[model samples]
Target chain A: MRAGKGLKWVTLLRRVADTQDTDAFAALFEHFAPRVKAFLIKSGADHAMAEECAQDVMVTVWRKAGQFDASRASVATWIFTIARNRRIDMLRRDRRPEPEDLNWGPEEEPDQLDILSLQQESDQLVAAIAELPEKQRVMIERAYFGELSHSEIADETGLPLGTIKSRIRLALERLRHSLS
Target chain B: MITHHLSDKLLMAYSTGTLPEAFNLAVATHIAMCDECRARLASFDAVGGAVLEEVSEPSVTMRADALSATLARVKAQPPVQRKVAVPPKDDVIPAPLRDYLGADGEIRWRSLGGGAKQMVLETSEHATARLLFIPAGTAVPDHTHGGLELTLVLQGAFADEHDRFGRGDVEIADEETHHQPVAEMGEDCICLAVTDAPLKFRGLIPRLAQPFLGI
Candidate 1:
């Protein structure tokens, strides 16, 4: 069923890429737009800004659909990256002096062994996150979802800056170990 | 090969898109040269995907016309023409830096004496980025940071109290770090440095020149 669902998304993306099909886009919008909005809100964007950013992210996904490589990243991962970048762009709108450069360029093709290992690691990510201790999980959530800097997290949590950095570092070490 | 690398926390912040633009530039430039860091970043991106999957759906719903409106906009707009980045023939500068350098493709360096020169890159108000060129075996004045400083070696290597930094390596220094960085003998060291505030130079000459340098 998981494999089937992944294939479905791949097909939908292909349809949008090949034909610029609105129907395919609509399906994607229905599934991802609300999630993107929620993700933005979790990152401290107000509701209005989150809604607008979500709309922009979907538009970008539509325009850049042709550039998506299913072999390199899953559809969900790709869409999540778009949403994250769009939120950052929104925050940087007035402050940034230069145009947003979103091009990551072509990633080097992975060897078969690398691809297999990465796939296995990707599959374990969710479980690894679940296994994190409560304090570590909270730190990760604040850093990733809340979009708080170390200092900001320190301020909010009333923890020393050094403590925040050390805890987050430990959590990342565990995640890296499990993923590797 | 890079002996030093960006900390995992920095890479995680970068992958999650939480870094300010200056830090983002440093990370992107370093990732351009280091394949290992790029692959590690991909894993962090996968973690972001997992975290997104677990975020419970919000109670707020989109406007009823959101999807239709998006489709209409998509139909109205022409397909975007993406400019494929040409890899630089000169290995000295990578593609990410090239995007910022623009047409002239040359840096106008301001000499800082002692065979060191710098060219500042315009960025956001929160941080400053500059390209520093230090001749081989020369030492930068001993100083500590007022805020965070992230430096990526683009050409030769440098050594400080912490460790040796080679091509594609990133050195993150904070207010607590105070050391003089010396370029390794071989080639002039070229680095992309981003800092939130000016350095606190210990020497009278460097301290006097700091204001004029705009670092």
Candidate 2:
């Protein structure tokens, strides 16, 4: 069940990639489409547009499943990139440039150990962010959600992230003590 | 080896899909040549992934037919996107940069005087993307940025008040930076320079329309 619980989305992607298995694709959609739609909505798309784009993103997910490499990214991270790119295309008139493919041939098979560590790291990263003080967490979320202007992002981040993280912690602790 | 790299803020912006198209192109080209930035970018991407994973289930659900509809579309579309035709690879220019230059990576450069030349790549209105060629020992004009500047060295190298930027290196300058960059001795320098605002030329009359680097 540990294996089953740890984003078996990775394994499911393999099935979808190898056999065009609709079952695996359905499972992925069931888990991610709503989140993708919400992400779009939060990023300022109207409901109708977000709904339509979510489907489009999921379809692209299935289409590009063959290119997914588990060693480098968790399934959620991979899907997030697809959703983000689709959002960019929806919002921007200009073409977005993407980094070149790592190589021309087939995506090399990810090592089993590498895949496990990546998934673990992804899980831990999510938990760590979840634990951030509201002020700190909101800033990050705002940055990712496009709530902050480019200048605001640039100016606010003048301090190193580690410095800001500690500042937020100290400020939050002081507030907590005052309340207590 | 790449000595300079993109800022964390810029990388996060790239991961978040908030950067202007020109900046995106510059960052993409840099990541193609630099693995350290590539790894940093992947970790930043993981944050987005985590956001998607732990996000509260939305109040709204996927339309009932969303899956079925997607499957039907899948039947119509091939499992893989048709490969974009691969142009012959340039030994120096990276793939994403090549994609924008289009067809053999040929560039037509306009003189910027002082043996420095530039070709502005067409990008969205939010920013300007240009390629600069400086003969060895040539000096680009002194300028300060109105907003932000990101320059990635593609061939040879250049040095300014800050440091030497070599192939795969990126130099990020903002409003406060004021300096002149001279192509290093030996090979000539070729770089992709992007700016979010007009470059304020120091002590030069502004050209009619070329607001960047007093072209």
Candidate 3:
């Protein structure tokens, strides 16, 4: 089932990339827009802003589809990257002090070895996350979804700052081991 | 060939897009140089995707015309040509920093005495970023940070009490940390540094000049 879903996503992205196919884009949007909205809202965006950001993410996906390399990243990973970047752009736009740090340098083509293991590595990542202890998982969630700094998480959770850092470091180490 | 790297927490913040812009510049610059961290970041991105998948669909749906509206907007704008900056010929500067440095790549350096010169990059208020050129064997004044300070080695190597940081290595320091960093003798050291607050210089001269240096 995972393979089937993954194949469909790759196909839809390719269609959008190769021919500017709106139907394919619509399918992509249907699958991703709500999820992106939820992700943004979880990161502290207002409801309306989350919705708008989600829409903007989809628009960017359509425009940059041609640049997508299926072998390097899964469709969901690619879309999530676009959503994350767009949300950051929106946040930066709202508070107008910072000069945009848009350049992340050249995107490297995925090494052939990495491409071969991409699917298995993703599966391992999901399984590894599921297996994390509840407390560790909570720390990861706060960092990822709440977008809280470690000190902020410490403040919100009443845990010592050192504890938060150690737990997250250990959890990530586990995830890395499992994925490798 | 990076001997030092961003800590896991910083990488996590960077992956989640929560880091302040100045820190983001440092992280991005390091990632541009270090493939190991870049691969690790991709793994974190995969985790992000998994979380997005696991969450129950948002109760609030997008507008029905959202897809069409997006299509219209796409048609209105020309396809984006992502300008991938060609890396400079010499390894002096990384690609991620080229936009800020511009084509000329010249910096107006202010001497920090003892052969160390610095050029501050204007960024957001959250942090101050600067390019520091330390001639071989010169040491920065002993100082502690008011808040957070992240330094990424761009060109050569430097060693503090903590450890030796080479190209692509990042040294994160905070209020509790105090050390003087000195460039290695063989070559000059160039570092891209981001600090959320001013450094607390130990020496009277540096302390007096701190205001003038604007560091």
Q: Each model's DockQ? A: 0.24, 0.30, 0.26
Top-TM-score candidate index: 2
Give candidate 3 misplaced runs (Cα > 4 Å): A1-4, A93-116, A130-135, A150-180, B76-90
Residue A138 lDDT (model 2): 77
What TM-score number comes out for model 2?
0.87
Per-candidate iRMS values, in order, are 7.5, 10.1, 7.4
Question: Which sections of candidate 1 miss by over 4 Å?
Answer: A1-7, A21-23, A93-123, A150-180, B78-90
DockQ of 1: 0.24
The TM-score that candidate 1 achieves is: 0.79
Cα distance off (Å), candidate 1, residue B209: 3.3
For B12-68, candidate 2 gives per-residue lDDT tens digits of 888888888899899999887766677777777877887787767548688888889
Q: Which ten residues in a row have the lowest lDDT in candidate 2 chain A?
A: A159-168
**Residue A72 lDDT in model 3?**
47
* Model 2 docking tier (incorrect/acceptable/medium/high): acceptable
The candidate maximizing DockQ is 2
TM per candidate comes to 0.79, 0.87, 0.81
